[model samples]
Target chain A: MHRIGDAPKVRRALVSAAVILSALFLLLPLVAIFAQAFSAGADVFWRNITQPDTLSAIGLTLFITVLTIPVNLVFGVALAWLVTRFRFPGRRLLQTLIDIPFAVSPVVAGLVYLLLYGRNGWIGGWLDTHDIQLMFAWPGILMVTIFVTCPFVARELIPLMQAQGSRDEEAAVTLGASGWTLFRRVTLPNIRWALLYGVILTNARAVGEFGAVSVVSGAIRGQTNTLPLHVELLYQDYNTVGAFASASLLALIALLTLATKAGLEWRAARREA
Target chain B: MSIRLKNIAKTYGKAGRGVSRALEPLDLDIHEGELIGLLGPSGSGKTTLLRIIAGLEAADTMSDRPSSIHFGDRDVTHLHVRDRRIGFVFQHYALFMHMSVFDNVAFGLTALPRKQRPSSGEIRARVQRLLEMVQLESLANRYPAQLSGGQQQRVSLARALALRPDVLLLDEPFGALDAKVRQELRRWLRHLHDELNFTSVFVTHDQEEALELSDRVVVMSNGRIEQIDSPEVLYRSPANRFVFEFLGDVNRLEGHVHDGTLTCGDARLDVDLDEGSHELLLRPHEIKLDEHPTELAHLPVTITAIAPVGAEVRVELEADWLAEPWLATIRHADFERLRIKRGQRLYAIPRQWHQFPAANQRSIASETMS
Candidate 1:
């Protein structure tokens, strides 16, 4: 092939170098966690991972992921549909507010929840009088998880739905589709891949969330502790194998997230093709 | 079904500030089973009018100027698009990219409310029938992305017809196809309309497409209809100068008329008119070229170019008195007989000419015997 630029060799070299460096930067930590987790052998790694506290942490993480994904799915789709399909006052402001969780620190999000639900905080006393526990409990952990992961689905969907536009929906409507029928047959099919994409990202964040869950979880050994908090607790106790093993489980979840996302993206590309 | 639109108008943005009228308050009646073409340039309210009829847009609503749109006897101006029972084909086809051609055509049938909905087996048969109509049955299972642009548009057509809507509206149905494909689709759509005998209103900016496809063509510009007539009448007797100029290529002759003589620069033509500045319009086929001047209206010019294509021979004429070169299309036999060539001097005689006094007013007159 003929060269098309003044310094093609140098440009190619620079791009390759950047790509290689970033790939290493991203992959090194993932490799190290698995390496350290199994350093004492598979038997020890399995033992650490199978411990009752570790198992409970995994369960809490899965439970939170399961609970949060569906809620965010509904909220994300509704918000995206409203923002993109209508012209109303404060529409831009609504879009920006939806992105707040992405911009705010996860720890700050947890603190905001605590300020609203802590024992001495606003509404916390009322909740205590009713014998409802929120702070340092599953509810607090779940709330923080939902807040931080809220934007994933909406953010993915808004631009896509905007780009797709309302033409198909209008076409469907003219063909005698009711509101629900239009959504199920026209709008939903169009956004299904993006919704899957958003769900996967939300699931990954809900499982691997650290700061927010850490603040509200109170590191409660087997109750409020998620996988990340349990990893921290094991490290603090100098149970290195246990800590790495728990960390590896989180890494595995992240890998599964990546795989599912990749699979969805492949299907989306095929659909487009 | 027949449609009657009463005083329908639309405006965008805040009134009296940055508002622009997209459609003037006007009434139109389309007979049942007639295919009408809304022909105009961009922003001329052709697509806007079509959308309003489809219930995709709400017409202007004011206490003093209420708009009503009717399909047969049913008033549907305030009705939702789904309830209005109109089938629309968008310019981009808008076929569901994720759905197979069969499912895309089945969408409308399945979307009907429970009591009105057809059985699954009935839907399957209806979809297959529509697919057969559009000649896309073999590609039933293929997704829209798998087919070519023309095929996708065909699938869209079948889908639109699935519900058996009272009226069908196509917005530049063949706009995205190639020239050959556009011609093919035009013929196909015309055939389908005739076979099904359904009322349809289509919007197009292509004069040829509009004239060829429409039973009656409505020429519009600046949110107002310039003329509405059969294609033959519209071509032969345009209602106004805008309609005349917009329909085809026009040669413009600007001059002052005085004492039965029209003079522009050095060129002169014996035309009886009031003493005032005027512009004469001539179609390419209206000007007859000869070796010498005739007794009627004539102008002398030198040939600049000659293009012999299709059935007509187009000759370009230039003269010092002419502001813009005049184009003339003659028969092939005439071209061979005259031995027309570049730089050949010839005289142009006007068989007839048209003029517009108030821009929108039509004033066509034949030259009087001197």
Candidate 2:
């Protein structure tokens, strides 16, 4: 007599059932988006994606991603190095604060920035006196995007850097390597893969950000509306085909992000081996 | 370069609360072109002392005790590791994972400032020469992950020496290798130390590694240096009981001494001592096995085991008087003549024994058996 948990047939059935259910739960919506996107044929899909406002939204999304990723890359590495390598007062507090952006709701984050930088807000008066517009403008959009993607890279890097310890860096220092040389030759190469992973995640999140950018964007046509906000506008106009088409664009980006992530993970595993 | 450590100490945590004193105040001077081994068990602060000299860790500072380190004439206590011109080989070879062996060795040479840096060709040639010295020229194109542990360690050595550092420090350089590979690397290190003629300090807990490799061994325990001597002197005349025990296997005989005789249980030995309790120490080879009881320091025992290998036969003996079993190593020729076997009754006569009044006592009062 076999134990119920030890039976191979039962175990295989249970595993297969769980996997199939989860796959359907995750994949069904993705498949629906694409099917509805091309349902009206390629011409309608192309027309929907190439509309002047849609094109500008896509451009705005790309612009936010391109600008913020580099900024986050530098900030993440510096923050990871500072938090992992040095011993100082408030280190634990600083580390905890870095993850606050990830925990905060994006809408709440947008509201917080609006309260600080909006035209009539705290820094707003100083900015208005200087005739600078941040609220409901491109700068406000950029600021909220930066806030949303802030923690991605550093969160990936901090634990890995901490676990690697300071042995290799110490070794480099003893060999007469200057600080810049130590970071370039020793530290960067070690953390490069994790850094790439963080950039990818940050790019995906920045491109797909909806609530935070919406709160600050003012949604002016072809001005500050990102791709997700444009999808909202198209849906609000009752243009079902156009809305899914734009939605499909974001979905396609999500798929590409997942593929790249899996590929990088495989490369990291092989490198570890 | 000659090195000196003056009044160096280290402590961790707060003074009044949860605190651990890692190192006590110490002073040491190492001569130029000499290879010294810091030998101790774990938590003995041997590695801590080596790190302090390499400038990886700072020594403690006190109002009255100021810590300072010197390399030749330069006072390097406050200097960073890069400016101190030292080279360190970690126990786990910390070779850059993404770079080839050639690139790893060339790291230091290429990292020099522009005015002081060597040309690309010169850097390549220098790296190749160092790799040749370590016998890793064939694997120069391979990454660290592609090489074996011993091969990785050889690359580490080549990389350390590429900069022509004033002082080279290795922390358990061969600790990660198997026994055979460890022996091979030890010989290689000794050869390199001599040919290059650089001052070097290495830390190890293995007594054999310390004794066989260093010109001088600094025996350490409990964050303090117990003795500093040539290996030959250390083995023959350990400065204290801890050193003797740490260096090799030691047998002990404990009893009360009255007049010139020491008695414990049913055992009696002729010892030169005043009336008091005494403990005697003997190396395995110092004990003699005999069939008849002698008038000297002899005790009756039963042969528990005999393992004859190569030139010597190791015999294990047990008696009521011994708190632990005693081992005696005799020649193969003697083993054959005596026909030693398990379960046979025998007498162990210690040819010589050393006595220290306490564990930390320095003077060794010895007596010879006739």
| Highest lDDT model number | 2
- Candidate 2 chain B lowest-lDDT run of ten: B361-370
lDDT tens readout by residue for model 1, B194-293: 9999999999999999999999999989899888999999998888888888899999999988887898876778887789898889989988888878
DockQ of each: 0.79, 0.84
Superposition error at A157 for model 1 (Å): 1.5
Give the true-contact fraction for every prediction, in order: 0.91, 0.91
Which candidate leads in DockQ? 2
- Candidate 2 Cα misplacement greater than 4 A, ranges: A1-12, A15-23, A269-273, B359-361
**What lDDT is reached at residue B220 by model 1?**
88
Q: Return the lDDT, model 1, position B250.
A: 97
B190-293, model 2: which lDDT tens digit per residue? 99899999999999999999999999999999889899999999988888889999999889899999879899888889887889888888899898888887
Q: lDDT, candidate 1, residue B101?
A: 91
Compared with the true structure, all predictions reach lDDT values of 0.90, 0.91
Cα lDDT tens digits for candidate 2, A25-109 = 9888888888888999999999999999999999999998999999999999999999999998899999999988889999999
Candidate 1, TM-score vs. the true structure?
0.93
User: On residues A1-273, what C-alpha lDDT tens digit does candidate 1 reach at each position?
Assistant: 656544878888888998899778987888999999999999999999889999999999889899999999999999999999998889999999998998999999888888889988799989988999998989889999999999999999999999999999998888888788899878998888889899988998899899988888798898889999999899999999899999998888889889888887787788556
